[model samples]
Target: MAQTGSTYTKCRQVGTTSYNKHMFLNSECMSAIDCAIMCKEVATCTAFTYDDLTKTCRLYQKIETINCELNKENGGITFTKETECHVNWETCGNSCYFYEGTTRRTLDEAIEYCISQGGYLAEVTDEEELDLVNSMIKGSVLLGCTLYDGYWQGRTSGQKLVFNDTMWAPNEPRGQGHKCIQIWKDHGKFDDISCLGIGDIICEKVSILRFHFIVTKASDL
Candidate 1:
């Protein structure tokens, strides 16, 4: 079944004309779909409004109004966060990362598991992001970048894995038999190892919401 309020509606009257205190950022978007995608990618965006006339996409950290209202003059629509990061997934930057510490799996198995959960293996983009992942993980975890042909490529982005000396451990990326990458907990640096070895899984997904409501437990009730 289709989700309610997923489609855009025409604006009959002027709602909130000026940018309110709730708005965090605004950008240019071609369509409502593009606006929605932008909102999803932002970690702090809980709601958004897109102006058809000006091609303006406004992202809000919180929605002040009960309903997502549209701008009458611009003939635009608004959208609120309808979904959130999956349970046990941590929101970081533009993606939701799930760190599985206890269970260990091979590189192939880890990739399959993340794919089954509508995500891909975790890809550390920068030093700052790597530090955040290092703080969350208890032990060594498998990463998304793998040795493809000759260069390292990300499974999710299909892009070359770019890194500096600071991103890697001392004498790492052991070329020959080592085909997979892992984040060493002790040093918090990238390490290349054989794909057959077992390691903790870290999964990454993009579609996430800012606010996550707590689910009450039946046992507590």
Candidate 2:
């Protein structure tokens, strides 16, 4: 069993049966990590299996404990389970967010830092997500959405953004050239400001499970 926000040790082999609700064939999964991300996206998914031979990934609602088979070629299958995020990160709505206030980084610097850490600026699209992000802010922080080409857009998806009006503070987005968005910790609302402005940084990426390979003897098959 895996504990949320803790390391997981046990792994399992897939049985002959397959769960069809969430399947990632070769075209969808380039690696086991990709498969894990797919599993993480589904709130109901509890485990996943990546087949090294067919390059297939499948999701399950529970761990498999019977009818296990081992491939002749070193098993060639890796099983993984959902686990808690790493330190300093919060997992919600199928995404992982990292908030840091110790050092302030400019918008560009924040983007660079997030890229270096394998994520991008946080993008809060809905009120639920916005509220979750708001709860994490100790102070203002740069978000992924920015004013681009006369419209607010999410950098990751490049789609037009339409957040709830209540998310913004009174008379907010006050001036021109204040394109980047920030979450004001005091009010838990948003404010538009210059991209060059500095503040705490929030990085976001798809939720992921820690990697753990299962070992099963041939006799167990």
Candidate 3:
């Protein structure tokens, strides 16, 4: 599986000499992978140093220089960010999303587009996720819900709609013939819209974390 978020390159026996002032977020992590995940969670963290002896991860908000000195006395692993974004997707909670802004597509076309990306139309399960999706979309966008036999169901596995009553706009669904659902970007509210309508699409898939190993000698640092 592919990893999500920042890329980390590990360097051993090397520690920053004068950039300690740039340290920002710090927490205890089980492994280097956990440290990388924590660094990715912090928007400003660009690099991190993990102390194997202390089991602590130190994140840096900025790296003004790459200078490093041999510190064999201290057991520390430094990871620098090579890139951001997990593959071609963005991380949100436990899922990865791909925002389509090229052109508006009908509901059917949107579904196909998401499938092409190895995902499906975004399925929102809670208010938090709904807000996350809303933040990514500027305008109305197609969701996974579709009308079936007078009831709304998700396009995948025919899962019935069980959203909270508050999720719907006041007097929404309106018993209209509209068979598809679109989420309003402003408030994360649901509204039934015509299936033929064209709108932006959000694709969702399971998130994976990728890790790459780079062994650097003391002289290479």
Candidate 4:
């Protein structure tokens, strides 16, 4: 059965194309196996989802988008652009990370970009997504967000923010837009904020199935 939780962004096909049987991907994050393994271990991982927003993997579940870049030369982990990645909760720490930028954006716009990159807004639900979000929470970085529309509060219309587990401060959202969440320098820790706010975002890799083994198994079957 297909899981139901979040709604990721998808293109509307402005024009016609030769074929509709194509998948686009980018060179980012750790291997897809790593992401899958992590998601499998993370109980909150409802969908090992990938947002075509920016052609990147949104490991966590949030209502906003992230623009991340790999550490040109992280300590010694020389992960290449072509490396596959998985979003399973257990592998959050092991998977590669992109430098989620510190730019303010609207919630709708943010999510749109994330979809273009092949991932979706963060989806924090249980301890798994919680720990994952906090791990990436850093200076000038916004964790899970709740824009003016209040989407990340775990409840929009009737949908609940299933796996989210973070604390929030009262009377935040100082932005004129007062939409995007932000972590002020004076703020205490990870909590709900606005989307127009600026902060570092986290992303992962989308796994690609190794069809060779599947093909072999099918033949044997």
Candidate 4 structure quality by residue, lDDT tens digits, 1-221: 01244332221212222212422222232444444443433333322323333333323222121111112212111112222354432233223323256664555654555556565445433444444555555544443345426444421223434322233334543335443343333443344444444455443333332211111122232
After superposition, which runs of candidate 1 have C-alpha atoms over 4 Å from their true positions?
Answer: 1-27, 42-49, 58-83, 210-221
Question: Each prediction's TM-score against the native?
Answer: 0.64, 0.59, 0.54, 0.37
lDDT of 3 by residue, 1-221 (tens): 11234444331223423443544555666777778866665445667766667776666766543223224423345576644345767766546888887798988899899899888888775677677777778788888887888677777746666778877877887766888878876667888788888888988876653434344455653
Model 4 spans > 4 angstroms off: 1-99, 102-109, 140-158, 162-166, 169-189, 204-221
* lDDT for position 112 in model 4: 56
Better of 2 and 3 by TM-score: 2
lDDT, candidate 2, 78-160, per-residue tens? 56555566677887756788888889988888989988888888888777777778778888888988897887898876778
In candidate 1, what residue range of length 10 has the lowest lDDT sum?
A: 1-10
- What ranking emerges by lDDT with the best candidate at the front? 1, 2, 3, 4
Query: Every model's Cα RMSD, please?
Result: 9.9, 9.0, 9.0, 16.7
> On residues 1-221, what C-alpha lDDT tens digit does candidate 1 reach at each position?
00113323322222333444344565766776777766665556677766668777677776663132332232334466755567887766567778887789988899999899888888886776787788789999998887888888887777777777788898887777788889988888998888777889888887444432222233423
